[model samples]
Target: MADSEDSTTPPAVSWRAILRGTGALPPAKKTGGAPSDPALQLWRNWQANHTQVVALTRQWQRIETQLIHSVGFPQVTIRLSGEEEPKIAHSVDEIEELLADEPEAERETLIAAFDAQQKRWDEAAATLGFDAVDAELRAALDKESDFTASVPTTKAASLPGIAAKLSIVIQLGEPSPKDTEFPWPELRSALADLARLASPEAAISPL
Candidate 1:
């Protein structure tokens, strides 16, 4: 006969299954500068605003997560440009496959396209001394469906007289480079202002 202890034993829980369970997730703890101190509270507000500004730099949150994968960031489901509300890349190929139909010039064009949008975002926010999308590009949805806006000039003046229309697509094993410049001048200014305030906490903590 089998032992009663063996019969009553529960199956072991694999780490994978434990991770899969969201029901046991712990709640986020809300902790920041002291509630009694207005100066510390103001600094905390600046810090929170900084996070919002950074999110705009990505143009979309999912794309942001994909660009920098880490814990605390959820596993974002990347979908192609479709009727879906959110889209990171036009086609799956844009992310990895088509590898960016290019001549060195075409690659530069693509990078420049995104750079211009970044320029618009940065210069606008800097002038206002506040982060906002103003008359244009304020709505993330406006940007989400704009695949062409994200694409750079089809061809730069890499070759003297060849029109891009006449050019042939070149396939390379490597992926096209992205516009790597995401500036945070507004955030920097806020931090600088906080530094100038020279509060005791500000002096002790540099962010």
Candidate 2:
């Protein structure tokens, strides 16, 4: 009788079957075609732009570090009115205030000096394919600006995840070398690895 009652009862619903029935399956596989959903496409575009931005940011960081380590700063001589030139104030705050007051005079001079140094640094970077990086970053920035204008300002949790992934990728691609701290070699190797991952042809391209 018990066996008969048990047999009469319907089989329990499988959790996996329930999930599949409820449309809870993993996302449909991408086939390299244009995304159908507008939101998804926007997210994808934002992801690509963010990747380039992060890469450029890392490259710029390396360049700035190298610059600071290699080039000695010019001794700033601030002529103070109080007495004895105020020991040639080197604090950024002091310089900022000084330049702020004399917009046409000291500000212009400071700007010109910065522009000259920036130009030289940019030129040096260009020689090392850094200019292309800047262009890529600019393009990414333009895309970001467009996306920002279009999207409603919402505190979406999605962006922070993508940003974090980008940060990790950049960090992994440019690991610090041991002993000798200079990472130019490591950075170049990492870039090559990234290029290879991006395209098989790049992996075998003649260096």
Candidate 3:
């Protein structure tokens, strides 16, 4: 009976799956703040413009995941060059294996679609200020004397790069990183400052 029940359990939904299932999911709960609140307004603004970036990001993620698996390289990166071939690195054997999974024509079509989608994603990210949010957060962090003192130089340098990742993770409704990898408490404190100090028109970028 236990085995039967276990076998019947559904697989967990990923963040990307949730994006795809947005229309089918229950309405999101309202977390109210005063009408004049900057963070609240910014959150609303993000909700409005994030659809394109989110969709493109999800699509690229799927392509990247498939390419990585087919190439037998977990960290393989994929990008499109203007009027040039897509940047995907693999040996002849790996390419052959990738081709075996999907016909050459279908694979080329997929890559072309991804290239167009990625350009749109880039435009949306720029217009929506995803990188700007990272800058805002990093700028806020730099002002904290105690935070600066506590964070090591190497970690401090990497914070800007990871700031966009942090934003994206939040947007995806993913769990926060463990304290061992990132100081969650410190991040929360910095966020508090960011909310309190940010201007009314502050740009809150997403991943």
RMSD of each: 26.8, 17.3, 19.8
Candidate 3 clash pair list: none
Per-candidate clashes come to 1, 0, 0
Candidate No. with top lDDT: 2
Query: Per-residue lDDT of 77-192 in model 2, one digit per residue for the tens?
Result: 55646556443433445466765655467755655555565566656665667567667778877876776554443222332222222323333334442223455454434434
lDDT (10s digit) by residue, model 3, range 1-207: 112221211122212222222321112223363322232223333433455445555555565455434433422233333435544533334434444555677556545655555555555555555555545444443433332232232121122212322333343443443332344445544533332233223332211
- Give the residue spans of candidate 1 off by over 4 A: 1-101, 131-207
Residue 172 deviation, candidate 2, in Å? 21
Let me know the TM-score candidate 3 reaches against the reference structure. 0.23
The lDDT per prediction is: 0.30, 0.44, 0.37
Ten contiguous residues with the weakest lDDT in model 3: 1-10
TM-score of each: 0.19, 0.40, 0.23
Off by over 4 Å in 2: 1-34, 72-75, 83-131, 153-207
Off by over 4 Å in 3: 1-100, 138-207
How far off is residue 171 in model 1, in Å?
54
Return whichever of 1 and 2 wins on lDDT: 2
